[model samples]
Target: MSHFPMDIIESLRSISRQTGLPIWLVGGTVRDWLLGRPAKDIDLIVPERAFEVGQHIADQLNGTYIPLFETVETARIVLRESKMIIDISNFRQKMLEADLFARDLTINAMALPLNGPFEPAQLIDPTNGHADLSRRQIRAVSKAALQADPVRILRAIRFTAMLGFHLEPQTQQWIAAEANRLIYPAMERITEEFFIILQHDKAHQYVDVMDKLGLVRVLLPECDRLRNIEQNNYHHTDVWAHTRLALAELEAILLSIDDLFPTHGEAVRHVLKQPMASTRCISDMLKFTMLLHDVGKATTQSKDADGIIHFYQHEKVGAHQSRAITKRFRLSNTETKFVQNVIRSHLRPLGLLAERDHLSRRAYHRYFRDTEKDGVVILLHALADISATRGKSNWQTRRQNLIDLIRQMLDYYYQPQPNPPLLNGTDLINAGVPPGAEIGRLLRQLAEEYAAGTITSREEALAFVKQAISPDATTTPHSDI
Candidate 1:
């Protein structure tokens, strides 16, 4: 009746009609339907004989069945058309109360009955879910309900952010009291819920709750130390706050980028905007790189004789520290490698721009060699990182310049024109060259000259190689030092 697939609803209706039992489409699907959201999943509850009803539905459609619920009889049947698992459970206990009591939040507990044709559809409101839905409040049915599944503490924040609802004062107090209970939940479960929060429109609000609940410190203890750490004149906020701002900016920019390209036109937008889900955004590489980008500041925070602060070699220090942290988190070798590359090349954006005037072929080779597949990803990360900085140092002008340089780098990166080798080992070996370490060294020297665009092809490479090996090399490669 609500624009759901007619065949599937009819399948359910037929099964209910044959069984001679009242069936109610209960829980989230009904809730989401009332909220005017898409409801792909449906749950059906019968007054009695849930297993028999489930078996009947399965037989009608030849679908898989699974038995659940310890006290009340409950089973699941996969519908043929929608392929949705219609959870079939019995309405047990004296008060028709299990439906509301079984759910975490009041708004999710409402149900819609689909019984005999003569009987009108009834809205089951055992827990005052209708009132809560109207008020836009996420309140637990009872205190015991909150205690039964502590993960609702996190879900409450997620729902609050996603639905633009507010937690009742009592429910908020309960959440504060039960925040520690989240530790008992499995990491996989926590991660699933956390990602759901991230997917929401205002996920940062959920994270803010997590921070207030002290769960962020529990989740990412490494960042806890940044809370009070001073960041010198260059930073407007403390390190932790800066990190949070960066993450917020990153999310905002990504969402803006996502909006610029509609879902249907995503393929066409690839040439203009980098795909949002590239290794740069959601990968563990991004997470670890973001975490460690400022980590070396802790170790390298130094005041010179002039009382000026410097974080020299912070990138190098952060790379090693990131590895240790990654190992502790039980990340895979590939993940660690990616994170390490991001950390190591974190400073390359600034370095690249520093020498932008005389961009050499050798510099391009070195840049490509270091970044590999993550070249573009690292550049994007750098853009986000630089944009995140709160310092007032003409960064607006500098940031735009860096963005242009990165675009040019991306152009060369995607283009297929071959980079002819300046000098090959074979060239040295064929030129009556001695079989010594000097030959390899001389080959590298010739390659450098080629990278400087001083030589273009094999003939030029041969000439350069021969000149370097000649005895009158007074005006040498590393000259005028």
Candidate 2:
């Protein structure tokens, strides 16, 4: 209790005295407090009437009361001013020890009295949770804990990563034995936990641990298929290994983005920090794309007549596959399209590199236009992918080149357009071009010409459209454009 802020402790004590119900600070809140971490969310277990008590607490504190779980009689009191949340719930079992035993991890199976005077000695650790916490070990309360709730498996891994604790041998065995049950959890739950893992700085370490525990295959079969798939001589390792290294390198680059691209580092950081949908950050989405960027290679692997391995159009194939995967995870439409677009156009930056000298302003415009705000993300992923593939040979030059290219792209994207569309749809319609798909196609072509410095004014655009619509023109009008 001494670990908590005095205001929270006094408020809870006042609420307990008013309600005349014994309240206990339970679960993760207590665990985090003992570990000296800031706990924003406070969980309170009461003997009964959890919702009623929660409402009273909310009213007394002028907070908002929300019924979180009606059937379970759980409610939440949000102290908006303090940015803290108090969750009140009925005990799962009649006795506190029984409730603690029903929890997933031993380290979390502890509680402290909230009504009584603050005292560290009042902690109730029925499963030796204090010892485990001191040892920095993650152990299950019981063998059936994970079997009962498969989501706990992911939670276990998350805690392992978050707390920098190793799972006890017995706990590891239980996770391995119950690994198949991970599929039972809702996709939303799995996705939430997966991205949370990626949000950590050492996400690559946890991902490797998840792969070793056999959870990766269940979650991403496409990635699993790349396990032993060989690549060309340009790559030092298999696809799976290279993918892992790319993720690690991606983290490194993001951390050091300031030094790499000093001109656009702030913009890049802002884009990465921007929220995608509700549950994921742009950086998390980027990491996910990096992991799956080459998944299509497993299916598209081939050898030419000269025995040179080729993964032609793998990015195109991977984009389609990533859509299905993102959909399966029940990600928002925005997130789904973001991941798909990044996968599809990941190779574009490198393509730009190849044609750097000849690439027109229109080409850069079209690249950014197709990729949207995710263009920077794709550029960073490409840098990581190229670095991992090339290994230790002159990677600094290549990396610096990619960073410079990204800086140029960012500058181009942020810079004011040198040529806004010289002609719009209405202008095209007035120019004798019928109002239909052809008008839209002609408008795009005119804009492309404008961007390419081919046409500078409305006269040039009308002339181009007239020539495009003429019967003497040999090339057919591109409706798809």
Best candidate per TM-score, number? Answer: 2
lDDT of 1: 0.68
Per-residue error (Å), model 1, residue 137? 3.7
Which sections of candidate 1 miss by over 4 Å?
Answer: 1-7, 46-51, 66-76, 89-96, 116-121, 258-292, 295-300, 311-337, 417-481
For residues 205-226, could you state the per-residue lDDT of candidate 1 as single tens digits?
A: 6667777767777656666666
Candidate 1: residue 220 Cα off by (Å): 1.5
My TM-score estimates for the predictions, one after another, are: 0.76, 0.90
Best by lDDT: 2
| Stretches of model 2 off by over 4 angstroms after superposition | 1-5, 80-83, 391-395, 418-421, 456-481
Clashes of 2: 0
For candidate 2, the lDDT comes to: 0.84
What is candidate 2's lDDT per residue for 90-164, written digit by digit as tens?
Answer: 988889999999999988899988777666588999999889998999899987989999889988889988999
Measured with C-alpha atoms, the lDDT of residue 441 in candidate 2 is 75
lDDT of 1 at 64: 80
